[model samples]
Target chain A: MRRIISILLLGIIALGITLSLAKIPFGTPKTKVGRYYIDKGVEETGATNIVTSVVVNYRAFDTLGEVTVLFIAAIGLGAVLTTGRRKKPERKIEPASLVLYTGCRFLFPLILLFGAYIFVHGHLTPGGGFQGGAIVASAFVLTYLGCRERRISERGSKLAESLGGLIFVIVGLVGLAVGGYFLMNFLPKGIPNFLFSAGIIPILYIVIGVKVGSELAGIIDNLIEESE
Target chain B: MSFLNHYIYYIGAFGLIFIGLYIVLVKHNLIKVIIGLSIMETGVNLFLISIGYIKGGTAPIFSTPEIEAARMVDPVPQALVLTAIVIGVAVLALALSLAIRLYQHYGTLNLRKIKEQRW
Candidate 1:
């Protein structure tokens, strides 16, 4: 009986959707060109990846806003997790398992390199600052778990995150001053599809990656420590 | 309201979100509230994934040689969902830990009795 009811409900839903789609106008109908951006975004933005153009150039302000939110969240976290006097908590994690230690020894460098690559090449690929940054953060988490004794220092985390955020905003402002627009692509467009090409996009992605990675690491650290 | 019909999946998803929100609001049971929060998050993730889905899209993985990239589902939302899932897990773990601490402090799960932190 339930199966029948579920099927009937699904059928009704399908019918409703079909009817509604008939009414809605989905962008430029029947225009293949309309499905994609009008101009070649890669050339216009000097970024190899179209997605990068959308994030770093088209919606640069939104990315900035996101980074600021992260910064605020980190500050809030630090405040909440703050305990008795000692500015930097000296609480230490234990030594990790041999397997984790050994495995991490092998994977950590590769992961870090890959993360940097992602951030560097974000302007020419599907990934971006957010994604790459998060990946790098996970790498820190791996190290934290593996070599528990040397879990990232709170001070270090804060410095890296805040500095990265400060650098990013400074870069954006520089663009506005130089190009008469915020996050303006300032440098030579470089070779169309190279890693060092897309002027400010690559640099911005790296900055974002650093900020995000540090913030996440700190948040995780606080949560784990608080739980214990 | 008419938009709901075209977005049937999202309509149901939104309904789940409200239902979950209500659960969180009304229920005193911490576990139940956590479950509600999870359900709400699932609704959001579902809506996002559905928004990225094409009418006749197939799996994004390129297992076959003649894989048509356009026909393949956009993997971006799925990628975002994966991050959401990780965040959800972290949040859940933290919530559960807090619940445990609450249990320790109050000697009971009744939220009414644990108003020490209430502003």
Candidate 2:
């Protein structure tokens, strides 16, 4: 009975969606704003990657809010898992295979470097802080799987998280002080297609990358510790 | 045949959305419901990306001088999806943590068994 009711509900919702979606034709230019961003984004923001320009430059305040949301979720997860916890006696655990431990130790630093590379090249490439941060977090997950005894330093991850957010806010405030608006592109936008160009964009992205990476790693750490 | 060519992405995306909805609605396990929610989020993200598709268009990046601005897909939707994906991950992690707490309290992940969770 419950399944039938839910199927009926879904059928109705699907009908409504299909009817509405048909009116909005596929494969066409729908927004004037998107067109404008593509045409002038490089010249204005000195970021060859238009999406990066849109995220870290055009809608930076919105990005700040997004970061805050992620931070709150992390803090909430930590709070939810840690409160009123009873300690359990540690159980004897078999060590990971030698190959697994050695492989993780070897690949961890390489993965971290690749993630840093992605965010640092945000202005000139397809990726940005969020993608890079996710990569970094995945590395930590691998560490947990292969090196059971090893743990991330809680103080260090928290410090990185706080510092990352602090730098982002500080940059925006400095931009506001120098210019009239929040997150203004106050620094010189050098020639496009270069790593050092796009001024505060790369800086903001690098900050976001660090912040998101540490926050996600902290979340993973919390979940792993709770399970064990 | 022509209709299928244009609406394939829309169809696929909505198919995912409906399947996710069904799972969330019918599944008794809290973890299954969370997985369904994640699938729904993926469908929504895919739908958003498909909306910005332009015929014969390339990515929105201006990596080289030859890439034409007029031929690039809309950057707005891509940017929006980027934000959405990160937010989705955050929400998923939080939900999983909550599920962990729930399981600990009740010793079972079945939502039907939890009286307060029942409608």
What TM-score would you give candidate 1 relative to the actual structure?
A: 0.69
Tens digits of per-residue lDDT, candidate 2, A1-228, equal 988998899899989988888777889999999999988898899999999999999999999999999999999999988867577678666789999999999999999999999999999988999999999999998999998888899999999999999999999999999998999999999999888999899999999999999999999998878555
DockQ result, candidate 2 = 0.91
lDDT tens digits, residue span B1-119, model 1: 76654567766766676667666666667878899999989987986677666666665432334655466444445545644554565456557656766776688776656686331
Candidate 1's displacement at residue B65, Å, is 18
User: Measured by TM-score, how close is model 2 to the native structure?
Assistant: 0.98
Evaluated on CA atoms against the true complex, candidate 1 attains a DockQ of: 0.11
Q: Over the full model, what C-alpha lDDT does candidate 2 score relative to the true structure?
A: 0.92
- TM-score per prediction, in order, is 0.69, 0.98
Query: Per-prediction DockQ scores?
Result: 0.11, 0.91
RMSD of each: 7.4, 1.2
